[model samples]
Target: MPATAGERPLTPAGRRVLEVASALFYERGIGQVGMELIAAEAGVTKKTVYDRFGSKEALVLAYLRARDERWRAFLDERLAAAPSPRERVLATFDALGEWLRAESARGCSMVNAVAEVPAPDHPVHRVAAEQKSWLRGLYADLIVQAGHGDAGGLADRLALLHEGAVVMFSVGAMADAPEIARDTAAALLP
Candidate 1:
């Protein structure tokens, strides 16, 4: 979790719990993992898990948010290395490709979470929606920075390609899906 003012940093045990839970949650479905398992894997008591995270739902949210922070930082570094706004826009696909091969072997965390937590009213849905919104908004900003028209429309299209590529890569077993997305997005852009 990003340290907010007045919020104490995670204790060593808390950090361990988060790390263990993160792996378990991603490797196994959320419903399959329990607090007992998390505590056992983290070498903490069940009480410690509750003391640190309050509830299972809260812990899941923290895990999701932490993953989101890491991804944003990774994409930011890739975007910064690019020379122009257009390159930066394309950089997202390159970053996604690298991310898929290096980190996201199982697929998008948000998408997976949304599938597991299917209720539209669920907090997981909100987080997944927010992540998609951020991607679309990022595309829009890059489009405008490149002095392109229809930023909103183009951003929406790019976001779809980006998302579709992930599903194709993870579920369809298309290893080159991200490159395909990049090429398709390039054709869409001015």
Candidate 2:
């Protein structure tokens, strides 16, 4: 009988593969990690992995999709906790700074993948761009809703700081990137 949609595997073996893939991608980057290494790490044969994800690109996309969902969820959670629209607008940078400080966190994986993928027509690049634009629009809307007279200006400024902080922290800049980001965010907030 053929396997069901969700019934790939439930034993320890399945978890091991995902755990290894996650760590490898997080550490060495997706472009550098290969299926052979993944299989070795998972104690499974290459055929098994092929059976699972079908292709390296598929695995990469799956990783990115999962990352995107988690990021959206985290931002939604933070917005829920924010007391006002102004706070919601500023939370983007504050949350970004906090996320960057994680020991295991390497900068945005989607951004990294886009940089490497290099094809504007690629689905991953399209998804990444959409995710970024969505966040920017979210901040802009929050700023407008907060009655800030210059909502577009505020959104543009915060977006620059947001992208700058990520790039700075990713490149091993000063240890105070997050603090600087928060301060900048406070200034942008109404």
Consecutive 10-residue window with the lowest summed lDDT within model 1:
1-10
Please provide, for model 2 over 62-138, each residue's C-alpha lDDT reduced to its tens digit, 9 standing for 90 to 100. 66666677677877887888898877766766667667776325677778888878989987797788877877787
Q: lDDT per prediction?
A: 0.90, 0.73
Candidate 1 achieves a global lDDT of 0.90
TM-score of each: 0.95, 0.81
- Which whole-number lDDT from 0 to 100 does residue 148 have in model 1? 99
Candidate 1 structure, TM-score to reference = 0.95
Candidate 2: lDDT over CA atoms?
A: 0.73
Which pairs clash inside model 1? none
